[model samples]
Target: MASSQRSRSSTLFCAFLTLLNDRLSESLIFPLLPFLLASFSNDGRIIGLLAGSYALAQFGFTPLIGALSDHYGRKPVIAGCVAGSVLGLGLFALTLSIDWASVAWVSGSSLPLGLLFLGRLIDGVSGGTAATASAVLADITPPERRAKAFGLIGVAFGLGFILGPAMGGLLGRINVMLPLLIAVAIAVLNLLLVVGVLPETHPPQARLPLPRKRDLQPFSPLARVLRDPRVRRLCSAFFLFFLGFSGFTAVLVLYFKQAFDWGPGLAGAAFLVVGVVATVVQGGLIGPLVKRLGEWRLSLAGLGFVIAGCLLIAVAAPATAKVLVFSGVALLALGTGLVTPCLRALVSRRLNDAGQGAALGSLQGLQSLAGFIGPPLAGLVYETISWKSPFWLGITLMAGVVLLVAGGLPGQAGPRAEVT
Candidate 1:
């Protein structure tokens, strides 16, 4: 019994290690943005394109990966994806250094635009990120413990962000290429570790052909999984919530730096504040809160807090408003952390084998859709109006989400509670 328990612990830890590596890739890149922009002499539109491209890849590819995981055993697909990520990051690092060798190696100069797209494409398609992690969680953890398992995943993510930006910022001061190189090394190591330690979650007998357009025609999958009205409500809630959240994230650093005349270090610190608050809320508060308030009510309350936080951002005074800005962003982070787990739990609880990945992938797809559209939209709004415009728009959208979830969720709950 003890050996069995230890084995389980080892597996969970391995899964977390991989997840942490994945998040490190995300968090480390943020602090390098200014360097990337200034060095490239890229305009704001191009910067937003870069930001949106990551999401575009994730959004475009995740569902396909999810379906593939379902059809194939999770192990091979995941391991391959991890290796792909290593290669992608390695190439990214190499590209930066290649500037010393020749301009041809960079993303866009002289080279075909197709090759430039391919770099982001590989990063997006090959990471085997959430899909693999989610499948691993499903394979390893009991249903009752899934929420806790996922919360721990969020904790890993938070810790990654906590360390990633600080490390990246410090390293970025040395050279713009430093963080990318570090990310590449970590990705390589993580790939090796995952292949060495992790077992296959799905077996070869279960493998299926990759999903086609006809198979996942949105309405077909949506109808299959979204039978429970609650699922629909949750999806709607997720859509709006992410739309607002993505818009805010897309703009916050630029807004702060411009409005307050802040440096990268200060902006990174503010990001740290968000990560700390989120870590506390998701890791520390969520499990107990779920026990007391129930997932549904907890989500609604979280939404309200998010709305209020955005409202506060709308009124914040630039430069001098550090206290208000941090406070509001902290609240926003807390609210989002609190809601995300419970809502994900709700979705996981509702789905059966037939629609599991598709459903989750759809939710992820919606979030990605937000990512694809949100940043550019925010950039446009910022250009046309003010940096503050995104926050105000987010506040309004979040308020609508709060209302929709409150009203629509109850009607959907009765049927969904039976899916499990």
Candidate 2:
């Protein structure tokens, strides 16, 4: 019995490490984006297009990969994705090498953009890790300890964010490609670890077939999913929440630069506070808070914090006051951390079947819609009127979310977990 427990613990530990590795490699690209943009033609629209394309690709692919995981089992899907990510990162790092060896001094600034989009698309298509990992956690953990299992996964992600961006920023200062190379190495290491150490979570006997992979229109599944009232409500609330949150995040660096004339390192540090706050709140406080207040109340608390954070941003003066700006971000993180798990749990419980991969994939597809719309909207807001416009809009959205939740918006109807 003791040996069995030890093996389970070891498996969880390795899974956590793999999750961290994936997150770190994925985020390394963000800090280098502006640098890459500078090297290219300094077109804001083009940059926005590139960012949106990454989001669109993720939106388009995560669900498909996730659904596929249900039929094929988790280990194979996750390993393949990690291996593919390593290849993608290698191509990203080698972008400049192609031009470097040429006799002609032709600029190769477009390579990063192309590689980034393609890499993100592949990663999106390959992101069965979360679905598989979540299923693995469910399989290993007793029902009473499930929240703890998910919370630990959140901790892994938070810890990765805490370190990933800072490292990416520091590495960016050395050379833009350096961070990409590090990401590639980490991915390679992650693949090896998974292949050598990880055991199969979903054995052949436990496997089930997934829905047929129809090449449907982008918004079709989203619309179909949203047609269910419960999913509609959750997605509506989530969309509003992310619309606000992503908008603010998209413009945060610009706000710092414009309002305080700060540098990239400091901007990176500000976001670091966000990751820390998110980690602490989600990992340490969420379980207790959810147990005490239940999902609805906890979600309200999160929405309230988001509103407050948006208001702070709207009124922010001299954004370079690192402490103050970071304080707002911390609040944002705190609120988001409180709410996300509840939102996700609601979904998880709703769909309480062996088909976690499909459900989560659908959820991710919904989540990615924010990525497509939020950043470009924020950029437009910043360009048209003021950098603070997005914050004001976020505040308004959060206010609506709060009011809706407070009004018993979801209502005590069908199982809250089904459509999540």
Per-residue lDDT of candidate 1, residues 364-409 (tens digit): 6777777777777777777777778888888888888777666644
Q: Candidate 2's residue-wise lDDT over 1-420, tens digit each?
A: 998887788779767877887677756666455554454433334444555655776677766666666668777777887887776667656653344335344444455557656765666556556666777788778899998788767777888878877887677667767777787788888888778777777777876777655743357666766676644676677777777677667666666666777665666676677778888887678878877777777787888887787777667676336566777877888999988777767655555576454555566676788877777777777777776787887888888767655555354543342222
- The numbered model that scores best in lDDT is 1
Q: How many clashes show up in model 2? A: 5
Tell me the lDDT of model 2 at 235. Answer: 62
Q: What stretches of model 2 exceed 4 Å from their correct place?
A: 1-10, 41-44, 96-112, 139-148, 169-177, 215-221, 344-362, 410-420
Instruction: Tell me how many clashing residue pairs each candidate has.
Output: 2, 5
**What lDDT score is found at residue 383 in candidate 1?**
72
Query: What TM-score would each prediction reach against the true structure?
Result: 0.82, 0.82
Residue runs of model 1 more than 4 Å from their true location after superposition: 1-13, 70-72, 97-117, 137-152, 196-201, 205-213, 216-230, 345-358, 408-420
